[model samples]
Target: MSRTSHICLMAEYNEWMNARLYEAAINLPIEKLNANRKAFFGSILGTLNHLVVADTIWLKRFAAHPANYVALDMIRDLPTPTSLDQMLFTDIQSLSEHRKSLDQAIIEWVHSIDEHDLDYVLSYSNMKGIPAQKNFFSLVMHFFNHQTHHRGQATTLLSQAGVDVGVTDLLALIPNETVA
Candidate 1:
């Protein structure tokens, strides 16, 4: 598969996994969801919130690319997250809704990206205010990878709380194309 095709797959996978994650998370007691189990970000809700914050920050940065992708134009008005650990939503419902919106935006943005645009270098400041320039394609890959990493943590947290997010695998989404 081409890089763009792989990214499109990741985008769809991101949305699917998030839907399952939120569904399982909402089944847990609100107190349990918010309970601090000493996980990275302190609780299930906190980690989930961090994912949203990170996506918002990265999407806003991608919107700054010179190619001017129309799909990312909507992100221009959205506020940049000041920190990765910022809590934008306190409850599961609000967080789930926002996650759906952000996932859709990600899917749209990835579809809008083409071969040449992937070669453009993106310059942006990190949360710590340090500046860096990196290949746009690699950053997009990291964007999806970052989500998967934290969602793995969330799956563990839920499992510890007696909930299971079934089929957390991107392989399940890949179609089987027979070769002659």
Candidate 2:
């Protein structure tokens, strides 16, 4: 499989994991979901909101690339997240709804990428206004990696609340090797 294929797989994995996480989150009591767990984002809902914010920020930045990908065209109208910890949705239902749409957008955006596009260097400023230049593919990798990292924290938070987000392994999406 190629790098583009791997990114697509990761996008699908992201959607799959997010669905499970939201289902688990909704099943729990609202108070429990909102209760302060002392996690980085403070609570389950907070962390989920953070995920959406971060995705929005990165997707908007990716739209700045010269490729003019139609997949990212929708991102142009959306408001840019001003901070990593911004809470765009206070409730799980609203958050989950936007998450579903955003995940679909992510899959579409990644699908629009080609090997040549990935090799292009993307220059963007961080949330702190620190500018940097790097390979677009590496940034894309970090995009997915950032999601996985936060999702891991969310899984832990869910576990602490006695909610289980099962089968998070990326291997679940990988095809079995053929024997020669």
Give one digit per residue, the lDDT tens place, for model 2 in 1-180: 899999999999999999989998987888888889999898999899999999999999899999988988778889998877788887788899999999989999889888899999899999888999999999999999999999999999999999888889998988898889
List where candidate 1 sits over 4 angstroms from the true fold. none
lDDT of 1 by residue, 1-180 (tens): 999999999999999999999999987888999989788898999999999998999999999988788888778888888777898988899889889988888899899888889999899999888999999999999999999999999999998889989999899999999999
After superposition, the stretches of candidate 2 with alpha carbons farther than 4 Å from their true spots are: none
lDDT of 2: 0.91
Clashes of each: 0, 0
Clashes of 1: 0
